[model samples]
Target: MSLTANLMKTGDAKDGAGSEFLAFTLGSEEYGIDILKVQEIRGYEAVTRIANAPEFIKGVINLRGIIIPVVDMRIKFNLGTPTYDQFTVVIILNIGGRIMGMVVDSVSDVTTLSPDQIKPAPEMGSAFNSDYMIGLGTIDERMLILVDIDKLMSSGEMGLIDKMAA
Candidate 1:
């Protein structure tokens, strides 16, 4: 299925109670993810590559002996390849019972967006799709691309990694 269809499905799954996001930056754009799914954030480190893995999969990192696959959000979001340097950090997130890490350029600050503040993602015909984006959050003058990490991960696609780890 397409990313937009997946996001629409996820948006419909949730009833209420509001949601919070941890904002971060990749290149010039700002993005956010549900805070409840974020496990932890750590500095970038060398990871062990897995054979025959997806291009977006950076590799597996042993986080205190629990191996977790890391995805380069830059590539996954079609934001292009990221130049890793001192500012790079890994945002470990748990989505749909799977633990994965995403390498981001840098992390901004956490922001809360009530249901009212979020507007459904805008549809634009282009190479880069906005299906993973749940909505656009406006806080003050800054715009946060509220991302549905679960949909972004596409749990079904990651089932292989989970099976390997199991």
Candidate 2:
């Protein structure tokens, strides 16, 4: 069967095989994650600091009885200094049965992109890993760095969730 026909069977298919991404801002660049993985978006909140954890792992928050680790994207992406203001928000994600929160500069709109609008991320050196990159998506004049949220969360650096299997 063709890609369009396969997408139509899924029921949520858009004009010819398209995917939805939740776009957010980090510094001057915009990034997107699979919409299905996002649980909710909330204003940045205080988290209980964890001792000896990586600086990127800001801390944990009690999210309706369940504690969830919150990661700062600025630190993870090596985006220099980060500042929190009225626009800062935390994106709660449910990836591979694990729940966590990602702190971003601001939340943008959800964008739908067809296959024609996506391009593979070019291979960078060891200092830059593109393992979690889905591709670069174009919407009008805007370019979004698409991310694979599941792989990012399960990466060895974010060890809390993966530690459970050990």
Candidate 3:
């Protein structure tokens, strides 16, 4: 079964355990986002470029007749030069009724973390703003930088800087 199907099948399998997150890699670091926001996962492909769009905004792609904008998390977060390989994939997301795509490295798996396993993101200076972080999730010896996809996608930095300044 597909990841989406797996998600639907186990929607409430861990009802009282905690929330689930879809783990994906950007560069060397691993990140996780709320699984509920993901629509589907697709392999990376060439996209139709838009005139004068930001470098971070790779382009757009047609998904079942719907055109959605694609954003490269590596470029957006300044992680490193992004490389497209067999493992690279686009994670289609539905944010506030608007559909979009995020390109990332290989996806690992769905992780269910209890409340006790989540730790607050420490407030500090870094390349990535803490505002976009939900927190840090710990499972075994691995750690996931939980991302608040909704906030990050709709934040002031994402084309809202001008509007917010007014």
Candidate 4:
């Protein structure tokens, strides 16, 4: 079965398993997003830089004739210098019918977290805005920064996503 379908099936249990999230790393921190938003994961590749585009927006990549904008999470969050290595990956996401790629350090795995395991994101001043955070997910000893990918991607500042469709 497709990963999406499989994950959906796994999450379908009425036992209150809550939602599934695709976990990925951005620097040393781990983050998670709703697995349903993820279309696929791909190895990082060179992109054609857009003239005058924001620094965080690396550029666009032609995926089977359709050009999709790729955003570098490290640069966008001011994590530090980003290195392109075998571990680097681009998470292709389908947000509101718009396909886009997000560059992350690497993908770990899909995790299932119950509602009780999620805690509200603390209001704080940081490079990554809390407004776009779903909450903090705790699984054993690991704490994942749960991101609201749709909100972050369609925010006014990104500009890459069309406002009308967002």
Candidate 5:
């Protein structure tokens, strides 16, 4: 099965549950992830840098004795280097049973989106592709770029963190 087919299945499942999104800001654009995947949100803290890791991997952090790999979403999305400030937040997510943290500019609010309100991601030509985007969620006049966290951090990619731990 292709990634698009898998995403279509996911979209079908989501259509029945009436999903909620945890919205956040990356620069001026708004992004969201399934609220069910979010574990917690914490203020940004300095991370212990890991040697020989990918550039997008910001390093690891000790969260309640668990070592979680942190990825800077701003850089991962090719937005730019993030500026640490009051609005900075680390969104802890449980993806495929692995806990990882993602740094974002700031968290907005959780909003509910019915299946009818969600639209397929637009085809955009760029280095950062839209495959990771599950759909486009709209509430009122705001748009949320809903992300598929599992696709964003696939098993193969997560294996790197496990390897580092070993």
Candidate 6:
């Protein structure tokens, strides 16, 4: 959809609580990511594992001619063992001019959420970090955990992304 149309449907990102999010599933939970950061969505493909890389970093995939690092959200979040099926999806994100891919269980659809509908994420515990969370968005009875993909992708733990960008 065009920018004007999107704004009309979802509201204004700057002025109001309106921002579009790409909803995806990880385990049994629903998560939302800023639509602006999403470059493309593709089906899961076999990736070449990287040597001496973190377990969460599932290695790289050659996109066109560029090899982009892929991270498994299930492993990163300790959700459980992830199974790659025909329905698995890879969300390609462009953050800070660097491109990376995130493996997700399945992608639903893009939903527009207003700020008023999003509530602050509750604290789980000291061990449970919510630093990368933007907030919790509510749509009807479903709650979408909004993530700051840019922050999560550029974090020090995501060393591969930094190395690739350099």
Question: TM-scores, in order shown?
Answer: 0.82, 0.86, 0.91, 0.89, 0.86, 0.87
Q: Spell out the clash pairs found in candidate 4.
A: none
In model 5, state the lDDT of residue 133.
Answer: 92
- The per-prediction tally of clashing pairs is 0, 0, 0, 0, 0, 2
- Report RMSD (Å) for each prediction in the order shown: 8.3, 6.6, 3.4, 3.1, 7.9, 3.9
Best-performing candidate as measured by TM-score: 3
Tens-digit per-residue lDDT, 45-147, candidate 2: 8878887778888888889988888999988888878899998999888887788899999987777899899999878764446998989999899999998
For model 1, residues 72-122, the per-residue Cα lDDT tens digits are: 888866787789998788988888778889999988665667778888899
For all candidates in order, the CA lDDT equals: 0.79, 0.82, 0.87, 0.86, 0.83, 0.84
How would you order the candidates by TM-score, starting with the best?
3, 4, 6, 2, 5, 1
Instruction: For candidate 4, give the lDDT of residue 44.
Output: 96
Name the weakest run of 10 consecutive residues (lDDT summed) in model 6. Answer: 1-10
What is the Cα-based lDDT of residue 15 in candidate 6?
Answer: 58
Error of 5 at 20 (Å): 0.4
Q: Tell how far residue 116 is off in model 5, in angstroms.
A: 1.2
- Looking at model 6, residue 94 earns an lDDT score of 91
**Candidate 6 lDDT tens digits, 60-105:** 8999998899999989888889999987989889988888999999
lDDT of 3 by residue, 1-166 (tens): 3866776776777766898999999888899999989998999999987776778888888899887888899999989899999999999999888788999988988889899999999996978999999999999999999999999999865653223212
Better model by lDDT: candidate 2 vs candidate 6: 6
TM-score of 5: 0.86
Deviation of model 6 at 104, angstroms: 0.3
Off by over 4 Å in 1: 1-18, 163-166
